[model samples]
Target: MTTLIRYRDDAPQQALESSTDGAVIIERLAALGVGFERWSTSRSPLPAAASADAILAAYAAEIARLREQGGYTTADVVRLTPDHPEREALRGKFIEEHTHSEDEVRFFVEGGGAFYLHIGDSVYQLLCERGDLLRVPANARHWFDMGPRPRFTAIRLFTDPAGWVGHFTGDGLSARFPRYGEPYAGA
Candidate 1:
């Protein structure tokens, strides 16, 4: 299920708002200049272990639309499994707060992850599941958590030829909030 929990940056112990409803999620994220939508996953027969080429082909239409709409030039698929040798290292790289020079767009084909966006005075914890397409605006302060046993296949779109790159915030605010799969207990 896809979920969105909005909390005050200084008050991580309590959620200002939370919902699993797609419409609500979309509206909430859109208000923050972040795009969120559910794409139909049945466009092609995509297995959990689908290849990048296969995954790209499965959503070519949607990809084209996003490319036109967002001026995105390239798209790729990234899959990380529990058995991946560098899962821990990769997860660690993204769990810290960071920002990209270009928009960070992703379509979740399988499994899930969480994107913590620190915008203004609020931190929106967006849990993206299968079929969820989330577009975090360029230069948005955020970080991602793929969990300890990451098992997700995501299609990523990039406007830059160099693709995904993060600029760490060095604020260490991410550590103050609940991580992926952790129970949200407010202080």
Candidate 2:
């Protein structure tokens, strides 16, 4: 159940719009010059299932393609898995809404997550499952909820190799966007 929510940057108490429809999501994101797409795996050479050479080849091709299309130079995959004692605490206290100063992009390599983007008068609630990718533009103003830091993993992609250096919320507005549930597995 991937969703998209849009709203004013200063408010997160409620979404201006939200939906699970992929086409609608894509359309909304594309309007902001952001990219959102869903891909499926046939259990072949799609990185996770690939061997050393296969992985290298797949990335090489992707690098070339993205570089030509988006002036991308590198492709890096970073994974986050939390087993912290305060994982639940962090998740519970995780609703402090904020936004990246640049494009926020994530690809669910294994598990899933929630990406809530604040657009003008709307908050796009994106419930990203495995194989789903989301790109929220820089300064898009949003927050992420992984459900109290549950045992979830994801592969993140970024144009900036440093990755995920977010500007924390000082306004404390994350309380507004709609929360997420388990993604749709049979859709």
The alpha-carbon RMSD values of the candidates against the true structure, listed in the order shown, are 1.6, 5.1
Q: What is the lDDT of candidate 1?
A: 0.89
What TM-score, over all chains together, does every model reach? 0.95, 0.69
Task: Report the Cα lDDT for residue 104, model 1.
Answer: 93
Taking the candidates one at a time, how many backbone clashes does each contain? 1, 21
Candidate 2 lDDT by residue in tens digits, 1-187:
5666555555545345567788888887888777887765343325443343443344454435545755444555544456667766667553566766556656565566777665665556677776676767777677778764454444344566665466766755555444556332211
Task: Give the Å error, residue 53, model 1.
Answer: 1.0
Model 2, runs deviating above 4 Å: 5-18, 44-64, 81-95, 182-187
lDDT of 1 by residue, 63-156 (tens): 9999999999999989888899999999999889999989999998888999999999999999888999999999999999999999888999
- Which parts of model 1 have CA positions greater than 4 angstroms off? none
Per-residue lDDT value at 155 in model 1: 90
